[model samples]
Target: MAEEKFPINIWVNEERYEKLQTAGLADMCEEMLAGLKVIRVYANSAQRDKILQVFPTAKFDSATTKSIELLPREVKDAIFGKVVEKRSIDILEEFLGQY
Candidate 1:
């Protein structure tokens, strides 16, 4: 049987983007898979807070924030991506595994 693959989609705004970029998340992904795309969206503080609550160890260079949600990847051969509202210490460590 052939192995299945899924496309990843990451949703984040400028503030969050900077955090991820600083942590080298985007760079890591690009290094592993070329031609990957990331989308940015505006998110209010409340929305950002909610996501941050789920990940208390996230770091932020600025007070501003954005919304992010990682869709579950349960279906075979279906495109999916994990959401990241903020760059937490744990998440950063996890991303390091790619190296």
Candidate 2:
């Protein structure tokens, strides 16, 4: 399928912005160049475990794992009932920690 491009605004350090402009492969340099700041990822235990299987280096807090484990199975089922049809959520992850 053909990919779609959309505009997004972001903020970043001037140096990083210049680097992205130099690389030139990114479709949305302005958006990518922005947010040179840290990007936080949140996930629960079972989800974290699956991600770690693929990304062993991913950093996460133990508290988040515990909290996700505490969520009632029934509640999770209801909230994610329709999402199950998608099979998976390949949510965006920052690549090479690039800003």
Candidate 3:
């Protein structure tokens, strides 16, 4: 068995921000980095982390010291919606064609 780990940082969207204030910087980072999709800071944050929208795995690169935009929930939800809408259909189609 082996132990694996990665580091990550998360922030909020400013412009056009309908962002929920989940947890503060520290708590957000902790939960977001740990691969938790929902973030409720101080047990009372209206904000939600969009992490699960893309990476349901909740895994991220905390170590990369690069400026990464905290993707908006709207954008993520839209993308997820599009993909999910077709995923089952695509899977069935592919399986049927394999015969």
By lDDT, who's the top model here? Answer: 1
Better of 1 and 2 by lDDT: 1
lDDT of 3 by residue, 64-83 (tens): 63222344555434433332
- The per-model lDDT (C-alpha) reads 0.36, 0.32, 0.30
TM-score of each: 0.27, 0.25, 0.24
Query: Could you tell me the C-alpha RMSD of candidate 1 in Å?
Result: 14.9
Model 3 TM-score on a 0 to 1 scale:
0.24
- Evaluate model 1: give its lDDT: 0.36
Residue 6, candidate 2: Cα error in Å is 28
Model 2 agreement with the true structure over 1-99: per-residue lDDT tens digits: 543221111222454345434555233332323444311223434455544454454433345332223223343342232122322222222221221
| Model 3, residue 58: C-alpha shift (Å) | 18
Order of candidates by TM-score, top first?
Answer: 1, 2, 3
State the lDDT at 7 in candidate 2: 14
Query: Which structure is stronger by TM-score: 1 or 3?
Result: 1
Superposed model 1: Cα runs more than 4 Å off: 29-99
Q: Lowest summed-lDDT stretch of 10 residues in model 2?
A: 90-99
**lDDT value for candidate 2?**
0.32
